[model samples]
Target: MTRQNVSIVLIVVLGALLLAVPALAAALGNPALVGLATRVLIYAIAAASLNLVLGYGGMVSFGHAAFLGVGGYVVGILFHHFRFSEPLFGVIAGSDQLLVVLPAAVLITGILAAGIGALALRTSGVQFIMITLAFAQMLYFFFIALKTYGGDDGLVIRRRSALFDLDMRDDRTFFYVVLGFAVTFFAIYATVIRSRFGLLLGAIRQNESRVAAVGIAPYRYKLAAFVISGMGAGLAGALLANYQRFVSPDMLHWTKSGELMMMVILGGAGTLFGPLFGAAALISLETYLTQWTERWMLILGPVLILIVLFMRGGIAGLIDQLLRRLK
Candidate 1:
């Protein structure tokens, strides 16, 4: 088969496998896999969003985790207020609806990203990375100081948000919900990368001077991409908060941002489905390694380094090469 055919087959197979995960886990009496898969999907969303800016736009945001934390806190705070039957800031009311909370999380995160990107976009190279990290740390500390929402201890989401007739509290159900979002987000990401705006963004990444010389403002495009990426991360954060049943400042830590960055790079930064594969590979590796030994991370570090060293485009790139070999 040609590599293109193999690629098509691989995608179909992946979809089939994702759909069967719940049933497979149930048959094996390993319900934990369902939750694990859900977590993987959520991180995949975040990693994909980061990939948009870092991979295509050449905007390396080292503090992307702050947006995730922002999304989670939005949900957490809203739930808390709703549970207490209290209004937010003595006027705005809380919401337990998934529709309301999810959109709110994405919108709020996008707004924050716009504000931060306005300044961060002005710089480039290492300076951009450092500024992003600083902003993230500041947000992390801000959440830590918000004592009303459990502060450093984090807040528990006792009840999951309402989603029409679906019970999000159920692990399998939640997994499917997340899966749907992941699939939808990937479709949208693919479309965006193929559109005019996406083409322009790539041109800007390759030659910013040329794009600017043509009278096109590169800043606006970059900022737009950044905001969209942040919104996607926010959606992932809300899903993760629901999955973990908790929200904390740790979500916004630099290490979390680093992990997201690693996923994008590891999965093949410029390719569609790279983040999903990266998330699965990293999370699954860490998870299984932990069961084998407490030093799983020690093993994982060298393993990842080896992958980066040998694989041309991370896992996705390696797969393409192998498929071509078969062809």
Candidate 2:
């Protein structure tokens, strides 16, 4: 089958599965599973953002989680101290209007990312990775040192951000909100990858010197991709904080960044939907395994090792290969 035909089939199957989830959850009466799925979707968005940089732009950042934390903290600080009443510089804080907050989060993250990416892209290889990681650690410690808003203990969001009188505190409402953002971001990502800039970014990823020779500045393209990636992560963070009604320093940790990378790798890094699949599988496994036994990491470690050894392209790649064989 043609790639377009395959994509259509995949979309149909995925849409059916998503639509069936709530019904299945209701039938099983497993609120936990429903919650887990929601969490998976949120993280999937974050991981997909990471893929834009690491998988598409060939930028291996070890501090992408910093953007997530930054976005979450922006919401938290605005709500906590601003009395959850007034806006920043006359705009109301905790507006919770996804339309308002989502764009704000993306713009904020994009600015931060542009600054960081400009500096980090000056170096490559381990240096680039280490610099990004170091910056992320700095942000993590900064949050830890901020005595206000619970510091290391974290800050609680007393209420969900308001969204047109929508009861965001309702689990089902929150779940749909997250799902909507994930879908929207994924759509945006798809468009980006097909755009002229995305083509240049892909060229830079494959051959920087060649792209430069063709008059395209590799650094500029890469930085742009990095900023877009950060914006996606930031949006995910905003949704996450609303979902949990809390924000913490751990969200900025290097380990969380690594986990995002792992999710992309496990899902088939370069493929559009790989990160989502990877996040769902990994989070689902972690949730189920932890419930089944305390030593969940023990099992997870070996499984990951095996996947790396035997499935280099990840689950998405494997499925694609299988489909090709059937054809």
Candidate 3:
């Protein structure tokens, strides 16, 4: 078979396995495996969103985790208000509907992304990175001081946001919901990467001056990509909050941003499906390593360095090379 055919087949097999996770876990009599799968899927979505900017647009944002926290807080805050029958900001009422909550999270995060991107885009290289980091940290501290939502103690969600007759309380069901989002995001990524805007973003990444020479304003396109990326992360965060039933400032921490970046790089930065594979591999590795020792990062740190040095394209790139050799 051709390389394209092989790739298609591999993706099909992977999707099949993901879809059958609940049943496979049940047959193996290890239900917790589903939860692990769910975590991988959620992070996959977040990491993929980051890849759009970091991998494709060449924008290394250190504050991507801020959207994750924003999404989670939106869900938690709304739930808190819904329970108390109080209006948020004395105007907007709270909602427990996933339909309502998820969109609100996405909208708010997109707006935040646009505002931040406007300023961050004015700088490049390390300046851009530090500015993003600073903005994220500022938001982090703001959340820490917001006592109404448990502040640094975090907010506990007593119930998952309700869907139309869907029993999200069931681990398997929730896993499937998250899986659906992952799949949908992959589809969107596939479409976007082939679209005109995607082409422009790629050109901008290669040479912003060239794109500008072609009469396309790089800032607007970059800002749009940033907003879309943040929205995707927001959706993932909303699902994460529901999955864990908690939200805290830690979700927005720089470490969380680093993990998402790691996932993208480890999986193959520019590849469409790399984030999913990266998240799976990293999470699985972390799980096994932590089981053996609490200082797993000491081992992980070196391993990642080696990958950066040798396997510059990451695990996805490595697999592609092997496939080419076989062909």
TM-score of every candidate relative to the true structure: 0.97, 0.94, 0.98
For all candidates in order, the CA lDDT equals 0.92, 0.85, 0.93
How many steric clashes does model 2 contain?
Answer: 2
Estimate, for each residue in 227-325, the C-alpha lDDT of model 3 and write its tens digit.
999999999999999999999999999999999999999999978889988999999998889889999999999998998888889888989889999
Candidate 1, superposed: residue stretches over 4 Å from native? 1-5
Span of ten consecutive residues with least summed lDDT in model 3? 176-185
> What clash pairs does model 2 have?
87-91, 87-92
TM-score of 3: 0.98
Candidate 3, residue 308: Cα displacement in angstroms equals 1.4
Which consecutive 10 residues in model 1 have the weakest lDDT in total? 303-312
lDDT of 1 by residue, 39-128 (tens): 999999999999999989989999999999999999999999999989999997898898999999999999999999999999988999
Q: What is the lDDT of residue 97 in candidate 3?
A: 96
For this target, which candidate reaches the highest TM-score against the unseen true structure?
A: 3
